[model samples]
Target: MRRRKLLAGLAATAAAPLLGSGSVQADEALLGELLVTRLRDAMLGLGTAAAAPSSPEALATDFTRALADFDACRYASLAVRLPRLIRVGHALSTSGGDTEQHTLLAKTYLLATRMLVKMDEQQLGWMAADRAQQLAQSTGDVLAVAESARQLAVLARKAGWHDQALSIALSAADHPDLRGTGRAGAAVRGLLVQSASYTLARRGDRDGMRELTDEAAALAKELGATLLRDHGGGFSPLTVQLHRISAENHADDPRAALDAARAISLKALPSVERRSRALGDIAVTYDRLGRRSDCVRTLLAAERCAPQETHARPATKTLISSLLVSGPTSTELRGLAERSGVLV
Candidate 1:
């Protein structure tokens, strides 16, 4: 009876929550890792070619849906869907070779590249960006090529190659695509300028960051509209200011970061990803200020707004883990960390 009772007690203890196997955490971790590996395979040219035939119209529609999820910051869903989409896109690209179909393929990979970058798969993201750039070049569209350069810049920024990113954006700005003085040109110009701004910010060049930001803002006014595309070519005044908030967080004082963030209307952000990112940045600023309660609240808000980003993005996850380790040890903060799968 004593041995049986001891065994029962051990079983009960093993079933305890949080750190226990009852939550099926192994499955979740496997799924996340599988998704990451699939992305790496696709980006690094190791993916298997499936016989799944896809039509251009169908692929275009799927790409549009994926873009919707992307802007909505439904990142986990995107991670599941993007690899298949990229594969099918490449498979179909080899067939008829129509310009419209080719452009659609480029856009598909373009979206994939941007999503991969946000997911913090740097090497895979770099290859995806290059593939998108190559496809854009094949499409013979200068604007598409310019956008590809912008994507390359993003990958470079993430990889800590800030100077390379800055050069790519600036050189792309002078492309003939921007010579027309049209909305497209203004948009591309604004995007490249802002890209340069972010690079400068990451390098701790405050004055350079400000000057390029102002240039991007002027271009936004010249266009007199919002870009709001999946690619950075859709950069606008709000987008520029959003980057300003990010730049402030990186370069200026923590208080200055919050002040710059406050200067803009948070709800006016063009996409859920951008909005959540701004909140995450603010959370980081609060963390730096050692305002534990405010930091937890902001991080919780960000996760509520975009759970996938909170979980999948490197910087946001770092914030959550930082809080988990050193921030206040309370029910609320612990609950937030638990929900994010950060504490465990």
Candidate 2:
């Protein structure tokens, strides 16, 4: 009986160690996973908390962070971060299940969708954008819905689905709920005009593009929404884009085109993508003006701003080639091309 008791005690002692080791292993594994998750969340700029207040200042801060990431060519990071932040912001705004929260959520989702679209993740963008639209509709938030529709239109355009873009933008414009709200209606109309203009531009219809731009500008003025007058968005960068496009259509006046392009380039230095686009435009304008040295310099600046690989790469390459042809001997241009690695 003593031997039997001793054996049982030994078994218990062994089992205790085994069980403790197993438990420790399990805990260690869980901790590793948690560490990984937290790392990923940090890389994406997400916080552990929910949302914050809906003040413009708060929104602006969020916007600034997102924009900074975008300008730094951190598209994937921005894509992950903006959506999470926006979702949290929505949650905070609508914690009480208020109609205002619902509206704010829809808008935040729209911003998230835009970031996804910019990152070339169309499927996810469409899903989120559609969900935002549904939420806006449920809340009877016509302005929010209109903005959502406009974002969807942009996605469609980027995907080369011109018809879809037009339909969505026009639908937003015609939403009955927006009719009474001057600012909202005007904004929707501006989107429609911008959509049409882009479609026409893609089809190489210069006259149609001009007409739409004029119409969009007029409507924007009427509503006191001058932000989109030069382009679709209400920011200096978009304004630069508008000026550059205008210069493109006025080939005969190379000086005017160059002036506009230079202005855009100067204004876009802080933004990588915008700077690349502006530099490309400037190079093209300089080429048209027969300013060989200036064209080469502008092309080189553009090359510096471009991502190693981006949706804008092909266009940037074309601009480089045009500037090269207009500039110094093929040797210098070839050296620049090799350095950029954009042209073999």
Candidate 3:
């Protein structure tokens, strides 16, 4: 009975943070390592393929749930599920499933690529993105191909292959098929240009960045409403504005970043991930402007918005470490650091 009581107490302690708000539910490093291992195993096709879904309809249901998990920032759950998903997807494709299966697999790879990019696992991301491109091409889906190009551009930029990245994005944006799909076409093109703008910003080509951003803004303006497709193009005037914030921040113009950030309300962003990321960008801008308190406050808000994003991203972790050493510390700040596993 004593042992039983002790075990129950230990389980409760382990679960305490998950039951509370604004606390790390698990060790951040352990979570990251698990994500990396799972991602690697998935890409390598190491896991047993989950029993093939009884039908394409059932497979799609699972895929939809996986995408939802990603959108909700449930990274740990997504990581655990992706390897099996990948394996089953590949099996279905090889066993004469259908175009739907191939398209679904392509989208799955794209999703994995996006998550890997966020985790700064660029090398592995490239592999996933490459597979996405191949499968997307086979599906004859212009939008899917364009989305794959966008992911490739992002990966290339991270690799410092700026020229290659710019070429990929602009070429896709200019693809003849992308020009005639009306609002959907325009939104995907805008996403491509938005990607190009960031690559230019990384190259310190402020004028180039601004030019592409303005071009993307024009496309977004033409669309007039947010275009969110299941195969993965998400854009709007507000989305352009959000990209402007990050571009300006990257260009060393925190004032401009702040101006762009100030122009929109968090409620307007479509997803918790986007909203939290906007807050994260704002937090970094505050840090750049030497407003430590504002930085901490914005980060706290971001954590409230998405605890996993706040605690798991390396950029945020670096910012937290900087804040810790920069000046006087507050109890709130220390608590945040501890909860994020930045402090013992």
Assess every candidate by TM-score.
0.84, 0.57, 0.89
Root-mean-square deviation of Cα positions for candidate 2 versus the true structure, in angstroms = 12.8
Q: lDDT for each of the candidates?
A: 0.71, 0.56, 0.82
Model 2 local distance difference test score: 0.56
Segments of candidate 3 deviating more than 4 angstroms: 1-29, 49-52, 229-233
Measured on C-alpha atoms, candidate 3 has an lDDT of: 0.82
How many collisions per candidate? Answer: 0, 0, 0
Pick the winner on lDDT between candidates 1 and 2.
1
TM-score of 1: 0.84
For candidate 2, write residues 38-137 as lDDT tens digits.
Answer: 3234224444332433664565466556555555544434433454456465555556656665666566566566545544557667876887888899
If ranked by TM-score, best first, what sequence of candidates would result? 3, 1, 2
Candidate 3 residue pairs that clash: none
Looking at model 1, the pairs that clash are none
Model 3 lDDT per residue over 227-343, tens place = 964545369888899999999988889999999999989898888878888999999899999998999999999888888777787777888988999899999898888877786
